[model samples]
Target: MIEAVKIKTERLILRQWQDADRDPWRAMNADPEVMRYFPAPLTADESDALMTRCRDGIAQHGAGFWALERMQDGQFLGFVGLNCIGHDIAVKGQWEIGWRLARHAWGQGYATEAATASMAHGFGPMALPRIIAYTASTNLASMAVMQRIGMTHAAAEDFDHPLLPEGHPLRRHVVWEKIA
Candidate 1:
């Protein structure tokens, strides 16, 4: 097993999601601001399905995208972790590091704080040689975070998202890689 892991930083706690978190998580996932980069907000059923995948990821890999909670009141801020989002090109079974937070959870350093720990866990404890992150070209906030984390752009590796339209505003996603 991956062990019941808990990671703490100066201000955040990254832990596995609970059944009670479903509602808040679903609500966040449905927010227009939160889902703006997304093509569409997830339905309630999709939220449950995502939670199931989140639970399964933790159980299977010992650590996946974990729900981010504030230490003071134990609020469900958001989530940060690694996931094998299948792959593109010659890279197979790619494990990509990603994060998502409620609108209230933005502006603080929580995403970076949680993600920094996650990167360490992925490359350190998990011994992953590298991790990839992809995001919509226009999502400057997310792209900024990736750069802040020292990930470099692989422009030649960019591609149009298969699920999005051919010329959708968010169709082109830039790939960022952190190689050990």
Candidate 2:
């Protein structure tokens, strides 16, 4: 069944989002620090729409960003997985592996662990030859996670995010990738 492919990492359950997840999902996106790299927080309607998009994408594509949760207590922990992104050099039509855990979940290895699983899914089950982790140049925390997950910086091949306006904070992004 489509619902059965929810992937599990060490301490997190990457599962399909339920209708109940909208409130917490909205709250997580509404966090200023969590939405720092993105332009703005999603309004309630926007958040609802986003979850719908994610759901539809997965239903159509078989894999997309899954709703992550704590395995032990079933606590929602935002998301970690692959999403099609604005493409660039060295690898075109790349699936971007990414994560966003709550502030309470930081400093733990959750992001890295969950990301590792997603990366494996990218290279293994998903059978993609490559996956990338792109982040704002100044986002040390995100960069650290990328490094922790064994991705190496591809500085020579990095490109300023085209979707970001010139000089936007997220425009100065560094890319790290893993290729099989």
Candidate 3:
């Protein structure tokens, strides 16, 4: 089993979840602007369930989406880390990197900073052969972050997000990748 890990960047802490992170994580998940690319903002229960999944994944696998906190102020910015694709799709079983932050954290390069750390962890310790990221076609901001972290768009590998029903605006996703 992989060991529980925490990655520290110059301005952020990429670490496992904590009891204190629940409320802020819930608040971020419920923010409409923050969840704009998602199908809908998460309710408290939904947010809690997601948090539980993140916590449990880290416990079981040693790495997963981690809580992102600012080192300077100890604020919960959001989360950025690697997760295995549990869905039955082309990329199933692949490790995917993702992140979500409060609107206030936007345009600050935090996502890029944290994600770079995550990619290193995946490649360095996790020894993953490849890492991938995908988002709704409309989420240019996230796509930009992927690019900033040196992930190249694999347009030919793009696919519909099965969880999102056909014809859903968010179903059409764009894929990006970085190979170790």
Candidate 1 lDDT at 127 equals: 94
Can you write out model 1's per-residue Cα lDDT over 1-180, one digit (the tens) per residue?
A: 566577898888888889989999999999989999889999999989998898888878888889888998989987898888754533348888899999998998788888889899989988999998988888889988888888898788787887777868988888889997
> What is the lDDT ranking, best to worst?
3, 1, 2
- What lDDT does each candidate get? 0.86, 0.81, 0.93
On residues 54-81, what C-alpha lDDT tens digit does candidate 3 reach at each position?
A: 9888888899999999999999999999
Q: Model 2: per-residue lDDT, tens digit, 1-180?
A: 254268887788987778778888999889999888877888889889889877776776677888889999988888888887634543456788888878888888898888888888878877998788787788889989889888899897677767778968777778888886
TM-score computed on alpha carbons, candidate 1? 0.94
- State which candidate, 2 or 3, has the greater TM-score: 3
Off by over 4 Å in 1: 87-92
Candidate 2: worst-modelled 10 consecutive residues by lDDT: 85-94
Give one clash count per candidate, in the order shown: 0, 0, 0
Best by lDDT: 3
Instruction: Name the runs in model 3 displaced over 4 angstroms.
Output: none
Name the lDDT of candidate 3. 0.93
